[model samples]
Target chain A: MKTIKKVALTALAAAGFGAVPGLFGLPGSLLAPGFAATPGSAMAQECGTITLGAALSLTGKYSTNGLHTKNGYEFAIRKIKEAGGVKVGGKCYNFKVIYYDDESTPARGAQLAERLINQDKVQYMLGPYSSGLTKAIAPVTEKYKIPMVEAEGASRSLFNKGYKYLFAVLSTSEQYLASAVTLAAEVAEKRQGKKPSDVRIALVVENDPFSLDIRAGVKEDAAKYGMKIVIDDRMPRDLSDVSATLTKVKALKPDVLIASGHSKGAATLTRQVGEMKIDVPMIAITHCESADIIGKFGKTAEGFLCSTQWAETLSYKDPLFGSAADFNREFKAAYDMYKNRSVPYQAAQAAAAIYVFKDAFERAGSLDKEKVRDALAATDLMTFYGPIKFSPAGNNIAKPMVLRQVQNGQYNVVAPSKFASHKLIWPRKVQ
Target chain B: MFGLCDFFAQTCGNLSILFAAPVFNVQLLIDGVLVGAVFALSAYGLALVWGVMNVKNLAQGDFVMVGGYLTWWLTQTFGVSPWVLLAGLVASFALLWGLGWLLYRLVIAKVIDRDLFTSLLATFGIAIVIAQVLNLIFGSDTQSVDPGYESLTLLGGAVTVAPQKLFAFLLAALLAAVVITFMKRSRMGQAIRATAQDPRAARVLGIDTDRVYAFTYSLNAAICGAAGALIVMIWVIQPFYGITYSIRAFVIVTAAGFGNLPGVIASGLGLGIFEQFGGFVLGAEFQQAIVVGVLVFVLLIRQIQQAMNRQVVQ
Candidate 1:
């Protein structure tokens, strides 16, 4: 045990000396005063359940993501059901969701959405787990003119595509990438105490559409900030070898490593970081906060940084968070699983999107799909994540985002001082 | 910056370094070669079985995965260091050997006199059954052994190699060489070879051909077990990933032609370099597509060679 400790100490020193960005260094320890006290949640008398449609991939490649979002949606439904329904404008309407697995295949998602609209006659639609699948079902939703809400497919241009009925819960892909650039600048200021523009960066992706969006977003914004993208190359999606990629990361010795992949593939990444002990810090843009990925590497993900939607350590009980604490508490009591690991932001986003549509329908005062579409287009309501103001087309959003840093396997907000519970954990130490 | 792929190429005029100069190119090669070695090791045992037992082992990869799951369990349960897990592997292999001998007596011997088509389908079914069983036991959570290398650097540029990976590469080469030499020189090796050449002749010469066949299969499985153990030290293992490894192994064996250890090593490394350079020119997203594409390309080449062989025979 003593020897293992000595070796671990020696290894960490050698890795730090290797002159790369440190491992996850953001302090996950600080506690947010949490959500402020809020008035009692509006309760409704059971007024019968109104069904919404979901064309989510329950199985196959995107199943893992779909499953998580489903948990979020279900947790929301459970909350509304427990409270007796949505208390809106003095009328209570129950929320019921109709879900189709879609199996992560594009064709199935399209067919499933069509079935939900026609056969099930669900008033609104929810859930499509991938960009391609979401795009496939977009036309279907538009045809019926039912208000569709999505947590997946953060493609910047999706909601931008002249659609009046589609609303998104999370930030657009471009917004997420912008957050990455933002983190890079903050890292340099806080850790390197140097100009953000001077920081060197490497761009690694899976050579897929999702990753491509990230790379393009970085390149487009990189020069604006004067940050040099020293390395830009993609490893294979099923990358079994990462030595060459890591080697280049070592040689270029960039200030940051940008990686994108599934949870399984991402596991090898942190382990490799521990092994070669490369100095450049890494930040994963998508699916990096996965419990499976982080759990495998443990402290190896310590100093790494990412722009995330939810962390278990957050004080969701704040007034700004609204019913997020209720959702979290209910989810834990029911499932015995923490929110961050099981109920990701997408799930909450999807469920809340449905509620927004329901409220829009109630406000519009009719099920005329087009009227609901107009109501969604004009919505300025507040939800768990804050205001739901959308642009004319409903793509570009005004949702507030908070930065998260990992410390000893926990995550805490490190940016946007109002929401920040802790100091920035930059260039985190592996130990 | 031009990136490290060219960092050394510019200074040393080493043309190969140019292939690895870009970070993307280097990463592609790293994934390919490290994975390629694993594929080679998995396929090596199959080649041995094909050569000695006169039976193509379609169920070979499934055995490799089964061995891997056992190792994963032992290490996870006992807190075994990866290096120390070799003993657990030996014990597991011994058990597998006993199972193999029993299988030979009850099933394989009954089908020994059957045609190729019959044997092939039967073993393929066996592969499906074994894979399903292992998948049930292990689940699909990508298991690996983290030795937590200090990530040493030897002054890298462009295609900078991780010392841990470099060490793994060296380890694969050394292991392959030792296993091949053992098979070539041992008395057991001669007996296995004798049985493969002519079972009737070997039996008449007092060799227990059945025992030889069963023993060779067990040793083949043991080699595969060792490969699995070493593989988790560097790569993550999943139940379904065995198919990719299996296909790559088959492709390398065909490219190198069976029974040539040096040729197999060359072919595996050659694919690794191709993938690395391919990422340089093509996109890395299709690297797996490229691997499968090259596999079909090699198959066509083999088909052409077979046609040429047939013409010569005529």
Candidate 2:
């Protein structure tokens, strides 16, 4: 009888320990104070705090961009505080974000989203780093009726799901590399004096939803120009090498090569292209700034065209962040790690997401989640990142994805004619 | 279902490409063989530990990552010369040897006499701890070191081989030869071999089996460390990338069977070539899937061989 009683007590103790995380969302709340208390103490004291929960990829594959996203959010919050916080319902509230490390996994992302909503009682959420992670957490936020202002997820499929509570400030993934294809066709028509249909494309993309959607976009655009896809390869997720596909590129001699993966994929592709001396006439890839290709690869990355959602040289401005170039300069001054490197679009759009939240909160004039979400849907504002206006589908529709070429170690916007800040370097020279 | 059809179409297209340009076969073969040389080093370490100590170490790849990180940090922090990077290889081996001894004293020594599952669980726990600690120290970015050597292009640049990869293959071979020589000629290696045959008999013959186990495990770690240092120079390493290496080691050892040195080398190279061909024909996405599929196939073949050896009695 005594043994049975002891067994029951032990079981109860074990169960209690297991339930602690679910009950309190221990890591999220424990990390919240340290992350939130860093901005402006005097302003925070004067204004009530509105807590926003974020489940970011703080420790896994996406951690590099995830850290950038986190830094962007924190930087924006600090700026907003210095600008006197968000005024809603005749009261000002400073933003305080509670962070949970999602470890770059979809399952963990969804679980953390639920914990943030149910356990921490957080009504507002900021998105995780990648489209894959955002897809995982969107259903949870939708189920809980919590509004999420996501900056990173650009997958077109994310919008087609008819999610009411999910809002994104970045352009969709399909638009990411479509401009590259269009540029390729334009080069063929103008320079080579050939039909657009004569252009050949080689695509090497990561197998994830984000890169695959980028692939689909490129394919759709390429088909519109009647261009042929010579080599279509899906790189593995943990991409270390893509030499085998590059070998095919050499044999086929495709006119243009478009590659998309996250930062790791970008780094690997850039490194191997240099080592192999792959001489494709034109090469365009995503996440070049995030990967720091110019800093890492130097001469090898000179002619590679990079697709970006935002560039510092753009003539975008707002009362809070001044100009797009101002945001770039001040952000670098605030974060030491970004010294000697350009601020990536991943970080820029993240700060823009926070600006969207502030705009919606001020316009709604209430603390209700549904009202803020409706305001987010109705948002039309120009910020340092870009002009963000959400379509009924909840994606920012006012912005266009720009193509930038690495000329003389600087990322200069060169495509789409209107956004061209520099001449497009045609037939990229081999190092 | 659409994915399956797409894969089939891709396979056919890739096969035709191979037939159309046979020069690519040379490129694939060269890449596979070079990568396999590095894979063999880690698998050889795993085989040594598994054969001598009867302990299945799931932390084999973590030891490699630790070595890679140490070399990368040294290169990045000190801006070391290529010659110093070579010295860093030896330094990593010695450091990892010490680490292996420390781990044996703390955890492995306790689990040595336990059941197989206990050793597996213990080593798995060690793997997680090592990965997490490395992540904390270095962050989760994928890092690699360039050896500053140019590549060799052949067949009108249709086939290119990085000089770093060739150097790594040669170094791996030299290391393997040295380890094989040491195992054959050294008294400690003889004791380890004897213990593997029969631990009780070796104990009766006045061999300190505990010390032999420690030395063997440490030597295995030292080999894996050297291999990892070479890998960082040629390829890339991340905190979470260790598991793929661990899986590759298991595949090589399982296919080769532990204690067979020649078999380990051959099977490692064979697996590498197979993966290259498979990834080339299918997409690079199938590279990991191919490793797992090989493991399952090898395991099934082993099960069948064991079943065949069993005699039914009436």
Candidate 3:
């Protein structure tokens, strides 16, 4: 008891150092994780090849997405190497992919992206499979003026800042969940055989910028169609049993439910709805595209129509179909061996951005940062998965979200009259 | 009606409305209870070291993390399920036990008669070094080894069990019970109890008190290791995950007074339920903050209570 008493008192002194004051700021950003690997310091060993930096997670909570983005990046790397690498005015720059493990920490990722650009001084950079990390390192890329073609980050604010350095291949934030909102609205609109005078909608989102953006975009679009957002409050990611939030949601009794969050969070909310037996027709934010919910919760994720810039299988029938087929094939081959969740969006686009960078540099006829930035900003090329284009603000809003639903426990592209590669299924009956 | 009244007061809404759907709140409470059991079981080890070992093991959390990764690797590499992995967990804990013994005998044993500041620094260093190594070996991936057991819903609401987590809860309780029973019933346990009460006297009585100390230290570590393995079955496991778990264990262990396993278990369940309520009412970002805050608050109260009790006795 005396020993325990003495030890218990230690917390008082240590409480002074435990002050976590605004960890979101740039100062905490610089208090870097010490495990960072030196690039040109040692990586110069493998010389005579053009170096590009990739800081991606292959493991961690975000590993599912990280691994997928790594695959996408690797896929592009393979394609780049096979084509004799980047062609700057027909002179091939044999690019060496300098990959590092960021481990999904925001501060660590910011420090690492800084190291990659400043130390090794790689002319170009790629990756990061999480929006949290991407937000951390976005300033670093902008500071250096290195045009990073983003394959996976979906924090719509990345473009809101008018940073020309970062270009994303993924969809805008949860607020811009065009496919999900449009699908829910159109189906209900058509079901009523006319546009309803009052389309009551409720917004349930995770407390993250990614989810916030999707929620915002959904509201923006809803207002455009004269729909009212009934409920808008951000819940925590770990708040799994959504009964309290959903009860409020059910009471508001919105005509449509626009749920936005990470895949696991999305799975929890969707599954809880099933468990609680709530029967409001729903649409998922972008995270609905991943295979975790379909795999873990199985069919509970079915009928959750979602808005995504990419899907796993596209019919190749639609002219504007996001490259879900190409992504699905390459992702399965690279993944599947690791018994983890399905591919995350961050992994997919971060990988594709490498090829986009290659194409941009080749088109510019120079490796100059300004020229490549211009080349990337002026990009109008079709990628393996989607028709690649970035707005002046560095967002590829051109690739409108392709709505999808879980049919028989698989992602099926279902909506947008032109991109309707498959028919939309509803009311998934749990056996 | 009071549940509703309390709900409305806390939620600042109609308690009747929140209480009408007890499904969500109850489910969160159950999950919390199970999770808290795991936290309490692990925390008892830290409490034991603080109580009997007289040296706070800051590395207790890292041990949980290491033990979790070890179980993950064991299952992934050697085809061991959580049930079958009990033997392996015991062996691994025994290794931790040996390490803790070596650490205690070599370093901490000397510092036992010294100031609290030095022990704190030494243990903190041990924690950082262990955490760094695990980060390197594991490459910082979040892994859930859930064997995809169907979720069981009670009262037909959002409370769910992956079946694996339910088992982990039982494991935590059972292990905690065994430890409690051993302390209460065993001869060595009495000696441990005796030494904890009056170490100088126990030594004078031919207890070979150092051996007793070393044995208790190892036993505590082995228990912690088992708790770590059980945690990974329910939640995602990462290298640094132990740090959070460690803090959680410390919180519950300290709040419970470390004298009773049931108390520790109750406190752990209390924390889980508190966190679940926080998630429900406050928001998720505040979940960790709430846990840490409650822990700090409870510990402060306990320390003050102990200080007051000591002054009164004097």
Candidate 4:
């Protein structure tokens, strides 16, 4: 009984010691009243630095892409500082990115976004990687009336919620597959003297919003082209096995196969398709541009078509990066120095997301959130990544989607003739 | 509620029509059985260890994942592909057996005689450690082995079967046969059974029960490793996928009951078939849902059966 009493007292003492920080930190700040900032006057002083905050998935399933997104944002900021800081209210303000690891969970992302705005007092926001995380953080930014310019997050449903402050630089998820359908239709017309309506397509998608949006887009475009959808199925969650889908694809033998999912889904389809030896006239997958797909699939990825937002070979130019080629060279050199590898297209798009903000801040010429948001909404400019123009729904619809085909284990832009680095190789060669 | 009712009605209607049209194709059934064979091999390991040592190893699936990574490392890094990956699979099994012995000595030994839940929680911790260590070593990526086996179509090209899955099925069956034969005819196997039945009596009979326990656990790990090698050859594997395999093993072993070798095989195959049909009829989103749903359904049925037989769960 004496020993139990002593143990209880020790436990109580430990609890009290742990609570001391919270108890003492609150009232100790009450003596400091000069730190309070007046409304609208916070931005009136001459600015030396503007902090853009984000909650990124630095560790988790999305960590690989999250790291790339981080590199993109950092590279963009560094390039801006090198060129000259943004001129706002007749004063130059350098950029500083303040990020918190969201760990790839939506709830955690939303919580961190709230912390960034409420506690860190950030006025502008960049989104986390993936459509799901962006959707999670969108409401937090909207509640605070802070404008978020995001490079990723392609789900069409994100813009349908009537949120006023969420702007995306990447094309909507629906547009991801719409261009593939168009290219297929053009190929059918040229090669077989066939109308677009005669093309039969087998579509497999992941159940996530981004993939679902791609499915909706493909279906809409197929309908517009009069193409027939042979089979439209969602790959199983956890993506354990796609054999059932592959078996069905073998039986149906559609003219074109469109499969979209995350990185693993891409690898699974590529392997099983090889195993089942299910060869269609053409194969287009949404995540073909990801390193996981290329790294895992390797030589087998030949002749596969991929939907992309930016290509290093495109003719787009920007004041900061000079030309698309120059941006690629510089970006690749910088990325290699930092991490000893080439930068992914996702990273390039992320940097472009930052460019949108720079353009907006310069046009607005003020640190006010409303002014900057209005300037962003009115944006119609070109960057090394691509054109920056937002629709009423806050999606970038002005820039056209590029279709890239893997030839000899290298990604080459093949569609939208103006951006074509190589001709489209129809009826992918299987050996 | 109305939407659910409507969905049920639609499903019933589709089922009736599908029944008439022969929606359950031969190809799908064959694929289910092949996949189920893999599940059975892994499940056997879990049952063996659980019955002999009373250790509910939650890291059972992680053993399979580690086994797969071992084979992948050999194939990818060393470029060794002799005898359709036979050499690599053997090496993986031997390495996993050593790992199992180490794990038992370090962690499993402490919880060997504990209550079921305590062992369950401890093994769960071990599972997390294994998964994270694997991810750190292999770098979170999906990997598979390519045997360049062209699929052959059968039954009028209605059913396409890959050579790799067939090889996996044969290997799994062979391993199960060897284990059954060994258990029925070996001295160590008899000692293990003796200890499982009555440890005190077995000790009195001069059997080293502790040795039997360690051997049983390591043998289970080796079996899981062999099954994982087959999986890598046929399907893709990632570090986080260990839990799903573990769950499948647990479900199969529990539903089959202790020491029911034939029942384990039957349940694993049934699960595979049920998942395929569920994925086909309901959609791919419900594949895993149907797997877990069947587990619950099986448990409820077993409970009712036990109650009728005048048995109460302790």
Candidate 5:
């Protein structure tokens, strides 16, 4: 009886292990095809395939945005294929991305980058999900002299390192909420009849590379105006609560509150600030669209100033994806989950990175790494995302970060006068 | 390090703010006590299992997450009315109890008689599996349920308390009371206490110790599930957020000692208040650091007390 029980338990454990992956809704057979050699079946792939490697955060803390990044890459690849593939040196080649789950860790990202370069022999590379992971993989790719087009890593620190082969499609993090600071100073002077120096700022950001860079930018801008920083707090990584910080905000009565911690931060701030009825005049945060804050928290998310790299309302257009609104419509049609939700800028910028690669491959006219590197460095084109022009430091300098406010459940551009489609709502009323 | 110096300077600055106003202390204390009530609920469950079954279940936090997700998903899929959500909380308790029983039969039952390390490893594996399954089902998003209740403002709006949080705290206190009453008055509870005292002796007395062990673990899981349900309504829940709760449970149980119910409750609330004050003073970045630091401090104090006792014996 004891032996039989032991055998039964072992068999049950094996069955559980086998059924676990199936629970993720990804069949083992489907995953097998992604690892196997490309079958020469499609007419568009008559010439060959250009396999690009990416280490994404398919699990762990950043998995939500990681999935968004992966979908964006897949959507762009499908569109490119439907557009008759990329013609390089008078031959057609379909784009294929070899992906590895970085598990949202820096060490794993670096190791996977090495594996993709050495073991998979993938010459061209795509970026990871977060700034931390991208920071990890960039050094490996740079050491191998592999040209990479990344959409996510936005920390100014990433560009300052002078990586020659690295190219980014998104605006740097320093520009993320700097506009909010300027707007805060303007409101203080115009409405409150106070000098910029009298403006009180409270900053609560996640203690990560991305959000910290945002904090630095806000501080620098605030310092220029001689604004007082009343309560500066760094939110813990697994941020679930911020009542303590909000309590301080109430006590200090800061005129402006700036926060950046990706989606979770946005959600927490919106929910708790509304629940606690924190009566700050202005509140700005990152990742409002990615978090779907207006959809989740409804009226509480109203009057929130969100920073974005791209908005579908913009007039940017291209030959392949057409106008920004067209790309938005087509992407929603492709991904069912995004049907009722606003497509995040993370996905738009990710797709733009792929567009950059396609343009560079065509412009270079050769598969040689050096030629591709120079072509990427000289990238100057317009897509549905924005203009792609690389500075000497490999960061996109052509695009401007726009500030959008959640007005009546719609994200309308409200800042930088050149892009303001809606007026700023002062003294946000919590109902 | 410059960072350390900056931290100290910030902490001092925060301390001065506290002294200058003193009204903010009420806000911090109220927030801490409310948060601590939920922590105490889970810690009580951990204590019950550790004392009764001799098994250290590291998956306590994951159990809470499961409960929270169950409540959140139910509300999302069905209705968000107050009555419906209250039903969801009860359903979470019942469902988690069943899950606990299944886990006991499949994993915990076998490891119950093994060494301490064996149970710890088994539960750790269970934690990973539970967290992963939750991630797959929930898509790794942080979810919460809004109770749509108003907050009470006090001290000229310097301190505001959400009614949902107060409701959660009351529910937690009520549940703890009911569980304590059952443990003291019920026949099964006596058998479980007997088993905890001495399993071999209880077996000799025909107490059906296995049944007692199973019952104790399931009850603990049920308590944790209820706590999770409350947490979802009050704060937030995510798949990976389980480990933090697990760590908190371990800290509370360790500081309270085994089988000490009152000690668990007090220590849980104390830890909550300490975390709030610490986060407020040191900045919120050091909240988790403060938790682990307290664990170390508590252990060190216990060690010194034990050493002094040994010297007295000599």
Candidate 6:
């Protein structure tokens, strides 16, 4: 009984010591004061900066483009700060971007988006790399009512849903290949003196939602022009080999070949085109904008036209970057010095997304969520990434898809006449 | 369809378009055989490691990736000619063999004496580390080496074959043959076999089982490295491609079973042919599905067979 009493007293003393930190809030409150405060109500007012949170795919299959998107965000932030940031309610508020690596998975992307909103206390949000990731993150941002301006994630299905807070700067996936068919028709008429109906197309798409959307656009546009589809093949899931499809393509000898796949698929087609010697008049493949295609194929990459969201040679001008040319020159100089890289269309779109947010924030004239959202909805400004205007469904309807061809080992904008930096090169004069 | 007819005409190259009908799918078959040859090389390496070490090296493809990157780096850094592929193969093999030794000493040695589950989990961890490390070293980009080989028409133009692929096939076959001879005749091979059959008995008979294990792993890595060098010469490779290689190797070995050399070779070729034909007929979207499907089917059949054999014993 005497020993039991002593043990009970020791236990009580330990419990009292443990409760002291909980009751008095010793170092916890002092160490992390921001942890107890709300995001919009306290943090935004205290910092004098508008923090935009992003869950980017920094270390997975999408990491290549993810890093590009991150660089775009970084560049845009630097530019915004240089221009005295966005004006909100007579206050000059600087912009800051906080990012978490989502590892290219949709579930993890959603989780990180939530953490960024609730824990990191970001008022605004940026969309992730691919459409799948955006779809995952959109609902979380919507639930929290934080406005998200995204540059990538071009899936049309993402806009079909009625989500007000989420907006994308890049054109929808359907627009990707819609212009490819149009270009093929134009080339057939100009070069071969053939009618639009005379254009024969062979489509090889990657079996993913994004590529499937590209296929749908091609089909729809082909029907509009009455162009014939010779052979339609979906590249395997691994994107390992396309010999079988190429073998079929070799026989058909279609007037034009429109292929949409991942970066690897583009490289495979480029290599196989030379190896199998499939001679099509015009070869337009998506993902040529990727550094991998030219980096892998080198001179062999020449002559193929690629569907792109943005091209540096485009004549789009803005207050921040001066012109597309100026932006490219500045970006290349800075990015190459830091990471030895060239900026792609994805990076351009990412920076353009930030510009949209800056434009909206200043127009809203207040940091209020609904007001900023209204301003984003009313966005009708033109920048380096063409005219920025969002449809009621929050899809960017103004930016026209551009087709760029690799000529003399450099990407030149070739299609949508207004954006054309050069004449279309048909049949890729193979040496 | 006219397109189907055109396929035969184009495959038969310059043959009269009217004579397009043939009972055999010569084009797909040829493609399959060429692909099978590459798979066979990696399959042999996987089989050797799994049979002797009882450790499924999930990082098999990463080894192949490292080998490819090594060759690419050499070519890019030194402007090595395409013809130096033979020398590249030797260099890759030696370097990867050293890597194998290090892997065995650092990680594989820990799991060698553990349960199969432990080895699997540990190797999987190794695979993730290797993949991430490679990604960090070489950014996520698909790279390839040009061998400057043209396609050669075979069997009266019925089959179009890349000379580079044919070269890789021949080299793979020669290496497999040499390894087979080594296993059959070498004293070390006998010791390895003894250790695999009865580790305790082999140790009692004055055999150092640990040394055999290290040599076996290094040999596997060497084979994988040579195969990787061949792959870069013929096919495109990325940092993340190691998982696909691992999957292919696992499927081939499971289908062939442990310690069955001829079975491993035959099954690897069979899988390659099957995948090519399946991709063509069922559509390329189902190519990966076909590999996993075959693996699942084989496992089901084996399980049923095992249950039936157990009933007989009872």
Give the alpha carbon lDDT tens digit for every residue of B128-222 in model 6.
88778878888787788876566777666545677778888899889989998888899998888887788899999999999999999999999
Off by over 4 Å in 6: A1-47, A193-195, A337-342, B1-24, B153-159, B292-314
lDDT of 4 by residue, B41-76 (tens): 989988888887888889988899998988887788
TM-scores for chain B, in order?
0.78, 0.92, 0.86, 0.90, 0.93, 0.87
Provide the lowest-lDDT 10-residue window in model 1 chain B: B8-17
Q: Rank the candidates by TM-score, best first.
A: 5, 2, 6, 4, 3, 1
Error of 6 at A318 (Å): 1.3
Model 5 clash pairs?
Answer: none
Best by DockQ: 5
* Model 1, C-alpha of A274: deviation from truth (Å): 2.3
A142-239 per-residue lDDT for model 1 (tens digits): 88777787777776657657776787766666555556677778778877789989978877766666667767777777777899876676766556
lDDT of 5 by residue, A102-139 (tens): 98899999999999987677889999998898899999
The per-residue C-alpha lDDT of model 5 at residue A284 equals 94
lDDT of 3 by residue, B149-212 (tens): 5668666534555566678788777777788889889989888888888899998987878888
Q: Give each prediction's DockQ, rounded to 2 decimals.
A: 0.25, 0.41, 0.10, 0.35, 0.45, 0.35
Alpha-carbon shift of residue A279 in model 4 (angstroms):
2.6
Q: lDDT score, residue A213, model 3?
A: 75
Order of candidate numbers by lDDT, starting with the best: 5, 2, 4, 6, 3, 1
DockQ score for model 1 = 0.25
In order, what lDDT does every prediction score?
0.66, 0.87, 0.67, 0.82, 0.88, 0.81
Tens digits of per-residue lDDT for model 3 on A69-172?
Answer: 77667766765666566667655565566777886778888898988886666767785876788788789999988777777677777777878788887667
Quote each prediction's TM-score.
0.74, 0.90, 0.75, 0.85, 0.90, 0.88
Q: Is the docking of candidate 5 incorrect, acceptable, medium or high quality?
A: acceptable
Query: Which residue pairs does candidate 6 place in steric collision?
Result: A281-A427
At residue A316, candidate 3 shows an lDDT of 33
Interface C-alpha RMSD, model 3: 5.5
- What is candidate 3's CA lDDT for residue A336? 66
Each candidate's fnat, listed in order, reads 0.30, 0.45, 0.10, 0.34, 0.52, 0.37
Q: Which lDDT tens digits does candidate 2 get at residues A1-431? A: 99999999999997787678667867644533433213345743778788899999988767878999999999999999999999988888889899999988999999999988877788899999988899999999999888999998999999999999989999999999899999998899899999999999989999988899999999999999999998888987754567778877877789999999877788888888888888988999998876778877778899999999999998889999999999999999999988977787788888999999999999999888888988988999999888898888889889999999999998899987886999999899887
